[model samples]
Target chain A: MWAIQLFNGLSYSSILLLVALGLSITFGLMNVINMAHGEFLMIGAYMVYVTQHLFQQYAPAAWFDSYYIFALFVSFTVAFFLGMLLEMGLVKFLYRRPLDSLLATWGVGMMLQQAAKMIFGAPNVAVTSPSWLEGGLQLTSVVVLPYKRLFILALVIVCLLSLYIYLYRTAAGRSMRAVMQNRDMAGCLGISTRKVDRITFAIGSGIAGLAGSALALIGPIGSSLGTYYIVDAFMVVVLGGVGKLAGVVFGAVTIGVLNVFFESWLSASIAKVIVFVIVIAFLQWRPRGFVSLKTRALES
Target chain B: MKQGLGTINRESQFKWIVYMLILGMMLLAPLFLSDFRLMLLAKYVSFAIVAIGLALIWGYTGILSLGHGVFFGLGAYGMAMYLKLEASGGKLPDFMVWSGQNELPWFWMPFSSFFLTLLLIVIVPMGIAYGLGFLTFRNRIQGVQFTILTQALVLIVVTLLIGQQAFTGGSNGITGFKTILGYSLSDPTVKRVLYWITIGVLALLFALAYWMTKSRFKRVLLAIRDGENRLRFIGYNPAVFKAFIFAVSAGFAGIAGALFVLHVGIISPSMMGIVPSIEMVLWVAIGGRNSLSGAVLGALLINYAKTTFSEAYPSLWLFLLGGLFVISVILLPRGFMGLMKDGMQKIKKRRKREDANENNIDFTFGESKR
Candidate 1:
């Protein structure tokens, strides 16, 4: 029973880690709270839904084995483009005013939810896991590990590695890191901080979209899917301390484990409240969170 | 200094006159308006009181709490508990009984007394806000992070309220109040009196807030808003002031919540969620942040529009509200008062330039074209 719970908890944390990565980068670099992130996830889910429909209609049955691979492209490109558009159009002007950006992004989120509702109708939309992705690994009696969850776990690891490589190895990543450290200094050094910001925003949003598509494999997708995860994502980012990848991993695992343990005794809603209280108490003890960085922003 | 004091006295008298005119209008409103409309105004006024508290913290002091709905919810629940107990005639509430609760919970015992209920309503929210503010301020959690924590508070409270069905009446929330202190709530006279009470509280709180904003404490608050570290450098404890204002605002919200339950005749977990909390901020934003009159008027106007639009066009209303938020933040950053102040300045300038452009076709337009 403990193993089953642990496995489930680990997969849950994997999903959380994916969403938190985008949020951490956005917070650490842009310092703008992107409330519409969840909506981007919803858009990704819907994109997967659309791609699946297309695949069923025109793509060969043999090709159907790899529908999610195509779905990934669909979700990522659409979400990335939209994120860039949002940044250029709205979020860019409000960079100096974090409070305004928070509210404005929330407003944008509401509109996105309404737009999704108008397009998809006010109901949960289904996106099926491919046939081969179905079922579980029969480890032993009472210790079965679900294959869908395993797939998610495997995909999360791959994405994390690719993200690390993209962030640490590439020139764009280096410049992005430069911009994150100090925008004015980077701009003076002849780097187009504007381009770096646009790319970072797009990639962050794209990750959220990918996370959303992954979400569809486990559960039904709806306009509110983003709202549900957005708070948890913030909690993870906060508890881990902003700008630390390893912090996110640790936070996710701790939260995931705690939630599972609490769920055994308490109702889901009660468990949620308990988790929130725990986070609050933890925040009280360590306001800068577990991995506090000595940044110029922290002094203010 | 003498001349300044004289002008201040005259300005205060002018404010009193404005207050009287507004109060007179509210007092005479029941005669002109239908009971339903009057009742709606009463509800909106109750909301306006919450907006005033929000204005005190967010506008002047710069602690943008995103979870004030929790405070308001506790106030409503406190009132609801009393009303529920009164309706049940000292037994468990109907829902509790229906859900198989035999013994009366100890918490529900104190709520049986009307005065005690009111006291609890004020103190509980104030206590919660004080505790939260102390922790946040002591730890130096300010700005965007503090706002997010408050949002988390809303989620937590809402979850607990919804989960504890027997106590909180679950998602359905505590409702079906038939009377208050033996006065049948169905009676229009009682409602009118309640409306008057709400307006009375709102006026008194508004005055109190206005007075605070004029005092030395207001400077400390504004300083905290601008830079708390600087205030500390100068040898002042910013945390005390922040926590105090937070508690005071929470108290205001709590009273407003009780008045809200009385006016609207319902209090639910749904009312205390993130949406309502954000809407509370919207009221201050739309009305004119930092202006008491603006907060009150903004609350009344926004709620009036909300009801009218939602009733007339349910499908389009959410879009309208969302669009208003985006437009208000992006376009009208200072809100309605900012626009009004700008227009007033422009008019003053126009008067000075009128002699130069007297022959123009359109006075306002031609001045702009020049």
Candidate 2:
């Protein structure tokens, strides 16, 4: 029971972390809170739904097993390009004013959700896991974990690792770090902060796309699925300490475990209430977030 | 002393004119509009009250609270609980019974009395805002962080309400309210009276808020908005002031919620969701965030446009709203009031320039004659 619960918690945390990392990167680096971040995830899920339907109808039966992989790539590309377009057209101009960005993006989010409803209909779309990833791995008589969930967990780790490398090892990564540290100083040093911002936003949105693809495998897709995750993603960003990768991981795991344990003990609603109470308490202690940025000047 | 006395008399006359105008309008509105339109206007008046509260906080205090819908929701639910109890008349509300609740919950008993429920409607939201402000402001949370925290609060409250279907009436929310304060809500006469009462209350609240803005306390709020650190250096604890204003704002929002329930006869969770909260902010932004009258006018105009546009072009309304928000943020940062003020200034300048040109022409002609 403990092992199964642990696995469940980790898988939930992995998905949350993936979704929140995009928000954190955008918020932490650009100081812009993209309230429409969840819509990106929703778009990715819709893309997967469409791709899966197309593949099932047109492709050979043998290629169906690898459809999930194809969906992820397609969704990522679509969301990434869209993210770039959004950044260039809207977000870039609103960099200095974070609060306005929040409101504007919220408007954008509503438009996207309404558009999705108009196109996809209001009902939730049905998605199926690949045949190999279906069913559970039975460890004992009362202990079973879904294989798809385990796959999500593995995917999270791989994605995080690649993200870590891309953020730390590459020259662009260094420039991004510098810009995040001090935009004016980075600009003075000849760094193209605009280029870095666009790239970072695209990558962050791509991760959200990946999260959406994973979410389709786990549950139903709908126009407002993003709304459900948005609050949770914000909580993760807040709890993890804004702008820190490690904080995102920690926050996700803590919230995931607490949610599962509380749901087991109490009703789901009560568990969510308790989680929010905990987050409120946590915020009271560290308003800036769990991990404060290294530069003291950025405190404002 | 004579000049001061004259100024005082002038101000009093101005106030009387304004009061009489409001009284006349309120008395005359119900005569012209149908009951349905009267009810909608009452709803708009309630929203105007909420917008007034928002103006006090966002316009005066420079704190944009994204969770005001939570306060509105709490107030609505508080009144709904009372109305539902009265509707049941000593039995459990239908939803509770449907959820297998045999007895009335102990906490819900206080709301049985209309007076106590009205008191709770104001108190509950105020209490929550006070507690939240005490925790958040003291910790120095501001900017995007504060905004996100408020959004989280909205989410938690909304999710809790939705999930606790038995208690909150779930996604459908509490409806079917038949009466308020023993007055039949469905009766046209009763609704017309309520509409007058809403207008009166809104006028009184607006007057009080306008007076507060002209007070010394409001100066401190503006100071804090401009430079909290500087205000702190002058020995004012910004958190205390922020908390006080937050509670006051929530109190007004609570009253608006109660008024809203009276007018609409139904209160849904969606009414207090993030969307509505953002819309409230937009109203203030478009009306002129720094001006009290602007807030009220903005709320009425925007809501009117919303109803009209949605009715005319339901499919394109979202895009229009989105575009409005984007355009207002980008171009009309100071809002309609600012635009009006700027226009007035430009006219005065042009008039002065014409006077200078006329003087130059006259002087040159006179010199030629000499």
Candidate 3:
């Protein structure tokens, strides 16, 4: 039973890490709150719904697992283009003013939610797991692990590993890191900071798209589901420390484990309250976040 | 020094006259307008009061608290709990039974009394704000970081309210309130009286805030807003002042929420969500931060426009609001007040130039005659 709970915690943490990583990068590197980050995720979820419809109409006989792959690709592409458009049109002007950007992004988020409602109606749309991903793997007489959860966990690890390599190894990654540390200094050194910002934002939003696709597999998708994850995602970013990739992973794991333990001990509502109190206490101890930026350079 | 004192006195007397005229209009408004319009006006005034608190914190103190909806919600819920209990006639509310709660919870017992409910409206929000401010300000969290934390706080509170069906009325929230302080909420006479009471309370709060701002305490707040590090180096503890002002601002918001419950007769978690909090920030932005009168004017004008726009073109209201935000921030950085001030300065400059030209012509004529 204990092992099952532990696995459950890990599974939950994996999902959270996938959802929050994009937000952490955008906030840490760009200093943009991107209140519409979850909206990007919502867009991704809707894309999957659209893809499922297309598959049903045009390719009914095709393998069901193949549809998931197509949907994931479509989601990333759609979210990436939308994110780029938002950055170029609205977010770029408000880059110097974080507070104003927060308000504006919130407005964008509201508009997106209302638009989603108008398009999809205000109901939870069921997303079926593929036949291959169905059923649980029984580890012991008392312990069982769902295939979908395991798949999500493995996917998150692979995404993180690739992200780690991309951020730390490549020349483009180095330039991006330099820009995040100090925009003016990087610019003075002939680095195209603007391009880096646009690329980073796109990647961040595309990850959110991937998160939404994963989330749809686990639960019903809806217009307002983004609102549910936004707060938790933000908490993870703050607790893990901003501007550090490792911080996001740590934050997600801690919150997920704590939530599961609390839910087991108390009601779900009380568990949320407990998690909030803990975050608040954690913030009190480390206002700059648990992970400090290695370089002390002001970007804005 | 004496002349400066006299100028200040004259300025204050002029302000008093304006206040009296506004108070008189509010008092006589119900006599002319229908009860429904009067009620709508009262709601606007109540929101203006909340905006006033927002203006003080965000406008003057430079602390943008996006979670003010939480404080407002607390006050609304405090009043709703009392009204719900009163409506139940000493029995458990229906929601409690539906949620499998056989009896009212211990924590809810105090809210049954009107006095206790009112006290909680003030104390509860104030306590929460104080605790939060103490934790956050001491840690020196400001800017977007602070804003996100407050947003997170709002999410937690709203979710808690939605999930706890028994205590908080779930997603539907607490409604169907009939009376306040033994007066029928449905009765027009009671509503008129409530309107007058709200106006009186708002007037008193304005006076208090105005007086406080004129004091040395306000100078410190302004200084801190401009340069907190400098103020800290000068031996002032910025955290204490920030926390105190935050508490006061929250208390004012709580009062506004109480008034809102009396007027609207319903309180929902939606009222205190992240969107509403952002709307509150917009009110301050459009009005002119740092000016109390501007804040109230901005709230009334923007909300009035919203109501009218929503009625005329519901589908396009969000687009209009978004456009307004972009236009206001880009064109009128200091808001409407700044634009007005700039216009007045230009007029004054043109008039001065004309006067100087007239003086030069007169001198030439005098010299020619000599």
Q: Which one wins on DockQ? A: 1
Better of 2 and 3 by TM-score: 2
Q: Write out the backbone clash pairs for model 2.
A: none
Candidate with top TM-score is: 1
**Candidate 2 lDDT, B1-370, residue by residue in tens:** 4644775698669867976886698679999998888887888888888889998988888788899999988898888888888788778899888888888878788999888898999999999999988788898887687778787788778878888887788988988777776778899999888888888888888888988998999989999788888888899999999988999899889989988988898888889988788788888889988888788889989998988888888877767777777777778877898898789767755664586588753323233332
Lowest-sum lDDT 10-residue window in model 1 chain A: A291-300
Ranking the candidates on TM-score from highest down gives 1, 2, 3
Per model, state how many residue pairs clash: 0, 0, 0
- Interface RMSD after interface superposition, model 1: 1.5
List, residue by residue over B193-266, the lDDT tens digit for candidate 1. Answer: 88888888888988899899989989998999888888999999989899999999999999999988988889
Please state the error at residue A209 of candidate 1 in Å. Answer: 0.3
Candidate 1 residue runs with Cα over 4 Å from true position: A296-300, B1-15, B350-370
What fnat does each of the candidate structures reach?
Answer: 0.51, 0.55, 0.50
Residue B184 CA error for candidate 2 (Å)? 1.9
Per-residue error for B194 in candidate 1, Å, reads 0.6
Interface RMSD of each: 1.5, 1.9, 2.6
Per-model TM-score of chain B:
0.92, 0.90, 0.91
Q: How high is the lDDT of residue B303 in model 2?
A: 91
